[model samples]
Target: MPFDQPLPREVKVTDSASLFRLEERACDLSLNSRLDPAWVRANAALDGAHYLWPALWNSLAHRPEVPRQLRCELLITLRAGDRVVSWLDVLPADFNPLPRVTSREEGMQVSQLLDRAPSVREWLLREGGGSGQQ
Candidate 1:
């Protein structure tokens, strides 16, 4: 999906290999979105066990051209088999990813974080987000 497109709410993967692919896709998307690749390489890390992997991109917040309302963070959810494993946060420069949380409570926390951003909240309210396309 294009950067201008709406983000997906969740993504499903059957195994660790698929999860790794998802991480790569997320990183590629972030780079394509104009996030600094070098910064991403330096700051982005893979955490959690084989069932879950969350990736975050926070470079956009540093770009002045990006609007405040739209500067809301972005997250990509990762699932392994029948369970939700982790989430990726594509955040603004000013914000940091929330500490890793168990999959059970992640959905609610993601909602809370997105709600903190005006534009993101409106997008979620306007259109139910989905797991973004590869």
Candidate 2:
């Protein structure tokens, strides 16, 4: 499929097991007290992160071609002494596949982010189609 065009109705996927393997080898994209943009960029450039779409659709390969969606969260430490919590859901059927932040939070004192949840979605589309950072 062409990268410039919308995602096709069906995508060829290896398998769910393959996705797990990719996830196991993927990096953690969670931010702690400091919001490092470079970390997000670097991890997004990684091979595992780049192939997130294939992994995300691997399980649905067998089912009828339909929208594949997953809700995920990203924790970012704001420079203003607060934490900006972002939630996004990935819809691979769209032309822009990045997990755009649908909800946001502020001043939440929390640590240890759930990195894997958004890495597959956020990391892949961060540089291409989205405007905010996690």
What is the C-alpha lDDT profile of model 2 across 6-111, one tens digit per residue?
Answer: 3333222222233333233222312121123443443332222121221122223454343343332434332222223343333444214433223233111122
Going through the candidates in order, what is the number of backbone clashes in each?
5, 0
* RMSD of each predicted structure: 14.7, 14.9
lDDT scores for all predictions? 0.34, 0.31
Which stretches of model 1 miss by more than 4 angstroms? 1-8, 11-34, 46-73, 76-104, 117-134
Clashing pairs in 2: none
Please report the candidate that would top TM-score against the real structure: 1
Cα-based TM-score, every candidate: 0.27, 0.22
Looking at candidate 2, the ten consecutive residues that score lowest on lDDT are 49-58
lDDT of 1 by residue, 15-55 (tens): 33333443454465453332223322322233322222223
